[model samples]
Target: MTNPADVKVAVVGAGGKMGTRVSNNFAKSDYQASYVETSPAAAERVKDAGRELTDLETAVSGADVIVLAVPDIALGPVTETIAPMLQQGSIVITLDPAAAYAGLLKTIDGVAYLCAHPCHPSVFLERTSPEQWADTFGGQAAPQEVVAARQSGTDAQQALGDEVIRCMYGPVIDVHWVTVKQLAQLEPTLVETVGCMVGQFLKDVMDHAINEVGIPEPAVKAIFYGHVYIALTNALRGSNPFSDACLLAMDYGREAVIKDDWARIWDDEDLDRVLAKMLRLEKIER
Candidate 1:
């Protein structure tokens, strides 16, 4: 019988944004954890958080799981330095799938590469407490789901990674397993390419109404906010059907705003191009 408490976990870049969040959760878990950060400022942050810092080599030497919470662009060099030091059968968890999907991470022979991403609190989450409502990014009071991918590992390794993933992102609803490529498609493709662009476009159009059309800000906000909520509910959950006039207007808006080839973002070549831009690489090998 394996005791999870015996598992040594190392969080690289422990004082970074994602690193700090997970390290805070790991503080409350049973696993033996190490915080490693090379930046003097970040190291000071770790100390301020009451966590002792360990050297990178020493941290990866005996770690059962190594969480690289560093940014996507830094994943290559960070993992390259730590890969040789990783213990056999150790799991290297990246916070995002971009580097992994682009084949930028240094490969270790017997080590597993797992990428686990937080979905954050959903728009439709039934948040009750003030704390839950305040935790828009989750890993706090609000419950959220995680999407994970194991690029290389056994079933047992994935199961262990799942446990670690859940612990790092506490108050998690579930962990949905997918391949690294699928996870990449879900993130930069589905979330950033489509969702975030639409969100920003809404702001752009709203500003256009206020600035260009000379609509009063308060009037525009009151009507637009209400309609946005209703639009989401009606379109996503079918809570109510759009009126015939509203449908016609929506069709006009769609034709006017969206490109005919907008769905091309889902294509693999486009995804690779997007990832290359994000990772600051000339091209993605895989």
Candidate 2:
């Protein structure tokens, strides 16, 4: 295993959202770390946080693990520019799997590519502190699991990558390993397309209750939030059986709000279609 103190880590987009979060963790870790940001505002954030910024070429050349924290749309060009400059056996980490799964990232023979995405703090977590409760996104005070994929690497290489992954997203529960394609499917398909869309739809419904139905905002929120927890626990964990009337209402909801063909989003063609749109490519070659 590579010693954490001996590892050299570079965060390429250290000023952005995920970049800042991971950078905060890395800055406090034992690894030799460099913050690299090109955006003016982002670079200032890095500077304000008391970290010296390194030039792109210098950081890439020296890093044992390079985190490409740039946006998905910028990944192709960014990797094309830096992949060749990476040291032999160095690991390049991406925060998302979209570009990697879509075959948009540039690759080199000796370097490894990894994608690790946070599973955000679980709703069921027993967070006792104010800080933990406030940290819904994880990494600061709340513990979160991560899902990761390695495109090319030996077990030893992967261990080193995992060490970095845990540190950058520390207070981590566990790192779940999956193939790049599987990670992609779990993300945009199951999580975003279905889960997040449903969450947003819930918000819309709440708004309709307050605005159109003229329910008191506080009363609506109080009832909705408690029921959200009950719904999740009852449906997902089988904590308690839902009431008979609730089941009837749920059946009505499924008929009214969901399409019978919604499961088709898990199909390979659908995955490819979503990935193409995500990566801004006309089609996925494979």
Best by TM-score: 2
lDDT of 1 at 265: 89
Candidate 1 versus the native: TM-score?
0.96
Model 2 score (lDDT):
0.93
Instruction: Enumerate residue pairs that collide in model 2.
Output: none
Every model's TM-score? 0.96, 0.98
lDDT of 1 by residue, 1-286 (tens): 3466999999999999999999999998888999999899999999999999999999999899999999899999998888779899999999999999998899887888999999998888999999999998999899999999999988888989999998899899999999999999999999998889888988999999999999999999999999999999999999999999999999999899889998898889999999999999898886
Error of 1 at 72 (Å): 0.6
Q: Candidate 2 residues 1-286, lDDT tens each?
A: 6678999999999999999999999988899999899999999999999999999999999999999999998999999999768999999999999899888889898888999999999999999999999999999999999999998877777889999999999889999999998999999999998899999999999999999999999999999999999999998899999999999999999999999998999999999898889888899985
Relative to the true structure, how large is the alpha-carbon lDDT of every model? 0.93, 0.93
Q: Against the true structure, candidate 1 has what lDDT?
A: 0.93
Worst 10-residue lDDT window, candidate 2: 151-160
